[model samples]
Target: MPGDVGPLAVDIDGTLTDQNRALDARTLDVLRAWPAPVVVATGKAMPYPVALCEFLGIDSAVIAENGGVVVIEQADFLSVHGNPDAAAAVLADYREAGHDSGWGTVDLINRWRETERAVSRDQPLEPLEAIAADHGLVVVDTGFAYHVKSPDVSKGQGLETIATQMTFALGDTVAIGDSRNDVSMFEAVGTSIAVGNAPESVRAAADYVTEATYADGFLEAIEWVGTTD
Candidate 1:
């Protein structure tokens, strides 16, 4: 089972895009040609990645909101993970702490930016810590969203669910990504590939590194798997 391959979990953003936001066409074509199923595991909100997957012509599951949410179909939301009550409690705690910390839309981003400047001498985590402390939340430093996730909800768990449903052994999985949030998926799968564009930490943890980006990176990964034992 470990030798047999299964579904691949690929991340978006830095891995798929260059410094500017553009999907590599060649990479996209390679992914479309993959013999095994492809599942997109991302930290972006559902709608964004769902749209990306749709554009990519993928018909697989999308793990979004950094595993706080999962969408099996473009229209259906699968609450496979994340604790709503805990998330709410954290939100309330942030507000009560006078930080006005909560996740919403562009409004929240601006508010956090202001708060970020006011607190911690321009350190973002100052207010971030205040919010986390109030809510009793585990803060994942993604350098973007603070990621106030529920204890059990994660990309790894979501991948496991899909693997089980597909009758794919966990030991046969290959997870790829570029962000720190992807660390969980790396740990959960038998093989993990980090893109050339991945962060230093991510690259260090991966079993292999792709010479390509997006679908190209995915294609390199497949080739690596084919050649390795």
Candidate 2:
């Protein structure tokens, strides 16, 4: 069954990195020898995941911005959400509501994002969801940050698009993640693994939950999937 599986789609940030946000050397070594195609999916900016894929020698499509943008062949940026203006407006509303918002870091906070906008998750989700709904956008929690994008866009849709292009069935892909944003991909794929650091809701949505956190958890999930029938 391991041979039957297609590419391995892994989430960056909390799933790939430790608490300090750096990739573990041991995990990187495992990725270097990974048999299947590895796709980097994350709520971080497109460049971050793409660069990591390049470093790991992974030449597959990357799902970025909580599935708002998909990068194919490390060249073109396919906008899955296609509503950057609306996303920005919703973020502006969040700011007006006295919530701190930014696009990741303070320096690039004002920079324009083509598909999705990032905000602090410290704010209540209900009010933010209402604002996003008003602008036809969806709010996703990425553990570290909250992303606002189009309702039609999701990690599930991103994974589906990549699977179609790569000529693999959605069931053949294994999605690994550790946050609420990964729930979409969890629902899309036949096998979904959640890291130990994942919230309770995320763990419940996953087919299996790893005993370890961060990259250790990632490796655990990968080995389990490779050995299980």
Candidate 3:
């Protein structure tokens, strides 16, 4: 069973950080010392997670933009699905219509993204989903933002792709998250853990729910995995 456990794929925002959105130093050290590979799967831009990986000195794969982009071994990034420009155009239309449909900041709005485009979570999803559907795209609510991406692109698919590249079975992977966007990965992996701060729906979907929140919960997950199997 120990051999069956391959890698640990973790969500970044609410799972890895506290109220301040900072990674705990102890958690980073624990991950560095952990025997298994630790992959950062996040809804944030690719650069953010990539930078974090570099800072942590981890060589594992990274799932960024809520699975819109995947970075393997710190090599080139791979776009998972549809064109981001098309999605951006739809959001632009929404903006012209006086709808509050834009990224949180101008910097994020101008940032280079490959396959996924982000809009404010406050925007109505029905209208956005309709627009995305017209362009063969879909909308996923990441709690913090609404992602307009291809229907085929998801955190689950990204993780599965990474697992295949690493020559590990999908059943051997462990996925942990605290948001709706993470549901895909939770369904994709054999083991899923949800932090205490996660929504009820997210917690219900996980195989285990930690008593702690944020970094402490993540550390608990790692320790639980170590003791199991």
Please count the clashing residue pairs in each candidate, in the order shown.
Answer: 2, 0, 0
Worst 10 residues of 1 by lDDT: 112-121
- TM-score quality measure for candidate 3: 0.88
Error of 3 at 61 (Å): 0.8
Local accuracy of candidate 3 as per-residue lDDT tens digits, 44-126:
77788878878888885888877878878844446565577887787776666667655565647437777777787667778
Task: Give the candidate order by descending TM-score.
Answer: 3, 2, 1
10 residues in a row with least lDDT, candidate 3: 101-110
Task: Please give each candidate's TM-score.
Answer: 0.75, 0.87, 0.88
What do the candidate models score in CA lDDT, each in turn?
Answer: 0.65, 0.79, 0.79
The RMSD (Cα, Å) of candidate 1 is: 5.6
User: How well is each residue in 35-106 modelled by candidate 2, as lDDT tens digits?
Assistant: 666778888777777788788777747888877788778434365565888987887787788765743455
Pairs with backbone N, CA or C atoms under 3 Å apart (clashes), candidate 3: none
Clash pairs, candidate 1, are 27-215, 27-216
